[model samples]
Target: MSNSQQQYPFYFKSTIILFGISLVCYALFVLSDILAPIAFSLVIAILLNPMVTKLQKRGVNKIVAISLAIGLAFLIVAGIIYFITNQIVNFGDNLPQLKLKFNENLANVQQWLNTHLNITIAKQQKLANEALNSSQALLGRTVGGALGILSLIFLIPIYVFLLLYYKTLIINFFHEVFAEENSAKVSEVLGATKAAIQSYMVGLLLEALVVAVLNSVALMIIGLDYAILIGVIGALLNMLPYIGGIIAIALPVILASVTKDGYSTQLAVVISYIVIQFVDNNFLVPFLVSSRVKINAFFSVLVVLLGGALWGISGMFLSIPFVAILKIIFDRLPEMKPWGKLLGDEVPTRHKGEIWQRKRLRQEASNPEKEKSL
Candidate 1:
């Protein structure tokens, strides 16, 4: 048998690989609740590592440094929640007036539909009733999602603390996994992974802050209520790759349409968000986040959609970092370098055949005598 066949029959190997991938995916889906917070905690721990190191360098105890780092992270998150909660309370107080206005608009729209398309109010009511029939299940889903978020809030901190406290042990265990001869390569991979993830987290935080500021300023100028709240929320949502950007734009536009008068304010809000996104994509991302992950847009979108399909919103948020980690590993292994290359945004090189053809063309161009002989 040829060497290729001796290694493994291509079809059999391909089937085994596919099966293994499927099994891994199913396991992830099954254990998502347990795994999600762990994944989140790992990212947070990595982010806080710099602060811990700085404190240790200053002669602070390791436990004290970790505690301080976690406390700081908690305060930042709590501040965001405080703003959001106050806005929500104010919004709740105005809900009755908003509902009254919404009913008036609905009546106007129903009348217009009747006049233009001869659709009766009765028919419209029936259609709405049909929609309301599914509201119970929708409400259940909403409650479940809220409960999941609550769990994350409670679980994530504990996980992060344990991970930070045991970080040295984890690093040593990782080193021990590889042969002593490969210690240098293992350490290199670990260092690169740490730097990439740390940079990624910092870049994302800076991007979100900038986006929130721009959004708040624009919305305030446009005379929108809760401008700060909406802007911050939108920025947080926009952290999710492909899907978040669309929702970020749509959300403010919807709120403006419902709460504000005329199309001008709505249009301005949309235009402002678009401009923010344009600048973010062209400038902020390239300068901050792009180098750290180096993932191609196509695969990023693909993983995001798959994540959403498999694990809902949490998956969407987690997918990119997981993919980046995988890419880091792939790049570190010689046999897996091609897979890493596939995930990257680097420009393609000419094939050997194309290179040979180009060389022949160049030679002919350089030598008229050789060309004539050919």
Candidate 2:
């Protein structure tokens, strides 16, 4: 048998293995609707671990700490729900005015199109009517869909509470299952995983808060109606990464174009969103998240899109950290290190020559008597 023939079989096996892994990942994506809530709960549990630890240090029992953390989380969630509900109610009361303003803007757009092109007013009106009809159906579906989503929201806190309470038991079980020699390595990996998830969650929350406050204040200063609602939406969407900034800007611009008296206000809203995103990406995330999850831009975009495909908006929001965790595990395995390297931003430096040179120098530096003794 030739050497090349032997190598061909190895390459073919490796290809098969990769294909199998991809198939499994695709299946997981299809099932992500069921898994997303569980994933979200795990992320929350990691985020709250520090608080749980502090509470335990203060002599509180594990169950009590977990319960208290869950209670606080529920209260925070309730407050947000209360605020959003009030906003929706106020917006509902002003819907007629909003619709009128929207129609006025639509007229302006139609006028611009007529002036710029050879389109007839009748054709434009027909198009507008069709669009309005479609929008009504879409809005009805969206409202109905939201009720179903609200039902699922209750599951998150319960999942989080159970995860927190069982976290130690889970870790201990894993440690016991693994050989004693491998247990330390397993623990180290788990520790790193927890730290990465915690840092990501906290950093993201801080970024959202900063974006929300700055955006709301900027819009309020510009005298935009429903500035609070727009700001909150912007902050929430900003958690999704690259595409989120654009979505955040569009919402406010649409709102301004419809409700504001002038085009200048619409431009101002756009500029404010851009500035907030700039501050967030450049200044906020880097400092808050540290150098823990160093994913490259290409993979970042790919994972976010893949996540969006799998689980829609929630998947997109979770993709980066999810990929980061996978990368961490890949790096620890010898065969998967190359895949991990691909996911990382920085090119790892080759240390073979450096190590050889260092060893040579050390040998040269050693005394003759020491060398002879060795």
Candidate 3:
């Protein structure tokens, strides 16, 4: 058969691809406890690579440069942790007052429901008791989750150091696997992935800072207690794509309802968040985070939801970068370019024929003869 005329079995190929994807997903889910920390470490190591390179160019030893970069990153993280811990400590002091306000609101709600909806306070208490039981179980799971987080905190740094130290071996392994046939393409993909990730990570941090400031300022203007703390938290959660934004909004709204009298202040908080979200989605994301990663919003949200389903929050956070790396690789390979386009944000350009076709279709309502002839 001529090369151009060669035919492949579409169904078989698709089946194989589907099976491979399923197997990989299963493995990822099963080994998530082991893999998630490693994945995070690799991303952080990639982010720190430029610093290591710059230090090495200045005659710093490779090992020393890596150590210095890691140390600097550690100190910055520690400082942030300390600051947030202090905030939490201060926030704890208001718990009693918060509880009192919450109880008062709950009573008012019960009274309103009794008057308007004809629901009794006894029925509401029964429902609340059922919810409290479920919440207690949730609290236990949360405690276990905290311990897991602590373990990851200890493990990730070591993984990052090892990954950085063996970075040369990792690069060489890719070249060896691809061999000479596609060595150049592999190198290009690697470089592009690294640059995209580096820029995206740095830009993500900057964007989060801007969002935190905006949130804090809005809350402070409305005189919300613990505004700075809640704002910082919301900004951090907003890093996790679609779902985080919902949770971020809920926290302040709940606080507003509990602490403030009447619903006007709560309404203001919601309005403020809606405006901030509009600014964030339209302006901040395009300029900072989305500039490097070109995945379209539909797939971005889909992958995030899929990632969360498969590997929980770590997967949600990791999904975009993973998809971006895939896109870069896909676009380079001739057969995979279509797949790259599927994930990419680029809109398909309209040709003259398409526009002309639409114009004809619109005119066809008055031209039954022309439509029948066609």
Highest TM-score among the candidates is held by which one? 1
Clashes of 3: 0
How many backbone clashes can be found in candidate 2?
Answer: 0
Greater lDDT among 1 and 3 belongs to 3
Point out the worst 10-residue segment of candidate 3 by lDDT: 138-147
TM-score of each: 0.84, 0.79, 0.83
**lDDT for residue 119 in candidate 2, whole number 0-100:** 82
Writing each residue's lDDT as its tens digit, candidate 2 over 139-246 gives 332223543255257777788988998888989998999899998789888988888888888888888888889989999998998889889988888877787778
Residue by residue across 195-260, what tens digits does model 1's lDDT show?
888888788889999999998899999898788888988899888886788888887786777788
Candidate 2 vs candidate 3, TM-score winner: 3
**True-structure RMSD for candidate 1:** 4.6
Clashes of each: 0, 0, 0
Which residue ranges in model 3 land beyond 4 Å of their true spot? Answer: 1-9, 107-151, 349-374
1 or 2, which is superior by lDDT?
1
Best candidate per lDDT, number?
Answer: 3
Report how far residue 343 has shifted in candidate 3, in Å.
0.9
In Å, residue 61's CA in model 3 sits off its true spot by 1.6
lDDT of 2: 0.82
